[model samples]
Target chain A: MTYDWTLWIVFILIGLATTLPRGSFIILGERASLPEGLQKALRYAPAAALAAIVVPDVVLVGGVVEVLNPKLAAAFAAVLATQVSRNPWLPFIVGMGVLLGLRHFL
Target chain B: MSPSFREGAREGFRVFLPLSVGLIPWALVTGMTMGGVGFTPLQAMGMNVIVFAGTAQLGTLPLIAAGSPVWLIVVTAFVLNLRFIIFSAALARGFHGVPRAERWLAGHLLTDGVFATCLEKMLSHEDPRWRLGYYLAPSLWSWLLWQVFAFCGVMAAGSIPKSWSLEFMATIALIVLLVPMARLRPMLLAALTGGTLAVLLRGMPLRLGVIVAIIGGIAAGFAAERWQGAAR
Candidate 1:
């Protein structure tokens, strides 16, 4: 673990993960296909995975659940900004700005 | 390149130029996050050039920092990138009569923005002008912009003090990424359930909570979708 071989191995695994799944259909071409039900499920997986990662990041500080914090407030503002502007850039600007602002003030 | 390729390249660059702006903060943040996790700038850029996925990179770098199992890190990145499979399938079908080599190259280069642009211009258009040139230009430029900015982020993040919560930039980037995807009802349900379960299951070892939460979230979303279908 010391040479950071772990991260490097993870990178290789991730590279395979990236290329293999992406190349599956391209390589399979006209022969193989994913099931329709499975296809539907795939669409939601990223959303779920992202939420799983982010929720704790916001609610938990140093592995303890603490919702009343700058990150959560900033996350909420970002969520609201998304609805108000489809500009894509607005949410980050609003969210990060709020996080820094609140970290300063609160 | 040939005349057609040059034509496609020109159009690709033009269309891609606008979308390229949206990519700047993402690539830079990803690079910064690489550095944020204590990797040397070279290692940071190495991961960038190798993994080449923003979500997967942003998501898993934290796991590496957390000392989670290698398998867990790989699985998380794999799941985060699964959407690419769908993109690959659709991309294969949309652009007909492409050479086999080009298909391989295009698949490797494909990104969400490029996929959307391809669907609009190359896939549906059926124009001979929708040659490889049209697609490759944006794909390569997307790759190039990603590498250049990411490398820059790796270098820049080194200068910024860590107390600035520089890696929080990655979290905020993920937040922005997730917000757009959560637009649909099922998606919102999925995120909500996923987040809740993650909070409850936080005590799990090896960061297994993430996997459990993801599964729980997807199940919740599926149930909601099925329930909605019945209502309709």
Candidate 2:
């Protein structure tokens, strides 16, 4: 298959842009501190963004909310695993197991 | 184990273990899906190793499969990963004394999970070395597992069936991981704002909705913090 230079360029640009933020603050050193308020905001950004992505996906399947969806069931299992194991991997596994198992039933 | 190596290994292990659990299925699915879409195992693995961000990688898969322009794929991935900038800066503060080589290594290891775990550890611990280890441990595990799963998924691409329900499961996994972090009011606000904006703007092309959501969340969070500080 022919390699797409356009894709390669796009990927490189993306890589640079993605790396810039992470690298910028490091490169900047102590020249400036992130604004105190902005710092506070950053704390919640991940969770909120993630929730936005996850909630709808779990609750709404095929443009309809299905309370009995296995995805939600596995998600519940993951929450349990996270609480019980206090380990990140466990919840993910439990969730995956729930998903696979439920796949058979669905 | 010497203290240094022991710390490194421990840090590596913490990141490696749990991350493996989440990554295995995700990577496998990615690989399998890539194959289903016509990418070879080597190509899929290459993407995993090279791109290294799960969401962005997944986001670009369909585009790649559809023979979308390379620039579009790269641009989409870049926008999705812009948050790492904030994470890296926050982490750099904690690793001021780390050598350049170690810093680079740490950068490679840095991801959402490692950043969160390390941030918690840094807040609680004073030992730089231990802090480093604590941060590194889970990230290392996550990284290693991602590679293993990606490779396995690519190899077994044909065997793994696609289930739309599993997609929901993935979202749930992300939600479970995110809930504990929404502690502060500003954080809650940021999450709410970002998420709402994302949904509202989901129709925008090239995943620009995510970018808008991020900006909205950050701005809301900043305003909330400033207001709280003034009130105090």
Candidate 3:
């Protein structure tokens, strides 16, 4: 377990940054109207952010795109599962199940 | 203090309960990973309480382990959480009428799930007070569950074997949660674009690839929306 003064400083900085996003508008209250283009752009943030996190996890191996792997297989399977069943749990279950099965049996 | 508040709280909790199922695995993984990476229980708990952003926390852990400079770690966390800035701005409308202190507290507790749920509820409900309660209930619930599950993970760290591939399970959870959010064409475009580019640019240093992918996806979505508007 690593501990030092830097951890606390980094923690505080990240904490403040995290809070700023959630608190800024709420605190300002009356003076918060983003421009139309920016607003439209921001609407896409969630999907973009999620993709930014997920794609690399599945497709990239050690910073390089790997074509053959169980992780990629599971990611594709998850996408198909979502298409077949709108149930959110289905993709996760199917993907994890596929990954486990592939790892164990194949 | 009122019936509306009570009802709103209940509904908020109810709405959040389903979404939280997806996050539980990730929370556990976070705790396990924290412990695995040599973070003391105290550090893990502090991160769970203060940082509260899973993606950012996950991103920062590796850098911290690498003994990266404090500035770099801070930058990474900030960029990963940049989405929250947009979330907060969007949330302003929903929480416009709420008091200052509550609003600030709400911001501290805000998560992606709560923001989405609250936005949906705000669209459906006209009452401000109920909306506040609705938003607060789930935010608090999520915060509580995150802490509890993460603590459990830290405690059970060595007990859980690595071969379980728990890390992959967390990834699956994220994928499942994200795929549903792509119902609209613009959203679908954004996800595809971001996902594709993220893979293509995975080699980029400092995880800047994620930031690049996000910006590209947003731009692509914006273009698609504009084209659809023009066509319509």
Candidate 4:
């Protein structure tokens, strides 16, 4: 186990570094304008980051890409819900419902 | 809070409601994972309160468990959270003309979901109040819930059955968030490259793969946009 003091130090360091980047540009205010190209690239940041997170959760099992897990089906259901209803909440509901059912049956 | 700020907070909370469900499972799992690693409740909660980034905290837990040095742990978590720099820059644009103090607060509380919502509202020409309110409210909502669910996870550690598979909700949450953003060709390409690279690099340690994928996706998306512009 990490020493209590060591853990505290680590937490504080992590907190500072994480927040620094998050606040730096915002604090710069009107003094700085990110390049137009960079701003356009930032537009894709959400989609890219979210997909980076989602893919591993659904596709990987024991660090291997496996489609056998229930998450794959749930992902499909969620995507369909998003497409059909155009409601963000529906995908999570439908996905969870499908996951629960699949977990019970699979 | 000022009356307008209060109103903005309320609107932000309301808009974030849907995404909160997705956050619950992840927070619960994070708490439980902390407990599994023999962290005291105080330590666990302390980490959540201070290190507020869920992905970074979670990524670091495994390293801690393995007795990795403090430097390695810090570096890994830092890299994992590098995406927020991009978010902060983008948020600065969305929140242009806001007071410095308010912008500082927004920057501290920023998360990917809130940032995306704010960007969307800004791009659509919503009033400045709506934009600020929308961002602050959801960021607060998710932050509070993160603490609550994390504490719940610690208290109820090992109680949540694996069969519940609540963690999958995180992915589901991302799905809902990512889908709406994928309307554009560049967005789709970004998602494809990011998701594909993440899977391909899944074996990389310290969740470095996520950072790699994010960079790769952005590059692909940026190139795609430039190519389209040239053809036109």
Best by lDDT: 1
lDDT of 1 by residue, B151-195 (tens): 888998889777666666667777778887888899999999998
**What level of docking quality does candidate 3 show?**
medium
Q: Name the regions of candidate 2 deviating beyond 4 angstroms.
A: A1-14, A28-33, A55-106, B1-39, B54-83, B90-106, B112-145, B163-170, B183-185, B204-207, B224-232
Taking the candidates in order, what DockQ does each have? 0.59, 0.32, 0.53, 0.44
lDDT of 1 at A94: 84
* lDDT digits (tens) for residues B57-139 of candidate 4: 76667557757667766765665566677777666666776787887787778776777666666546445666677687788
RMSD (Å) of each candidate, 1 decimal: 2.6, 6.0, 4.2, 5.9
**Native interface contacts kept by each candidate, as a fraction:** 0.67, 0.42, 0.68, 0.70
Maximum-DockQ candidate: 1
Quote fnat for model 4. Answer: 0.70
Kindly report which residue stretches of model 3 are placed more than 4 angstroms away from their true locations once superposed: A1-9, A83-94, A100-106, B1-40, B54-87, B90-99, B116-135, B203-207
Give the 10-residue window scoring lowest on summed lDDT in candidate 2 chain A.
A1-10
Clashes per model (N, Cα, C within 3 A): 0, 15, 0, 1
Residue-level lDDT tens digits of model 3 in B15-112: 78988886777687678767766667888889889888777777666557657667666765665566677777777777767788888888888888
Of candidates 4 and 1, the better by lDDT: 1
User: What is the docking quality class of candidate 1?
Assistant: medium
* Tens digit of per-residue lDDT, candidate 2, span B1-232: 3386467557656554654565666676666555656555666666677667776666556556546556655655664565676777676666765556666666655677667656755556666577667666676677788888878767775565655332333354455546675667877787778767766676677666656776787788778878998999
Predicted chain B of candidate 1, TM-score versus the true chain B = 0.91
Once superposed on the true structure, which residue ranges of model 1 sit more than 4 Å away at CA? A1-3, A84-106, B94-101, B124-130
Ranking by DockQ: 1, 3, 4, 2
User: In candidate 3, what are the lDDT values of residues A19-62, reduced to their tens digit?
Assistant: 77667776776586667787678778767867776777777677
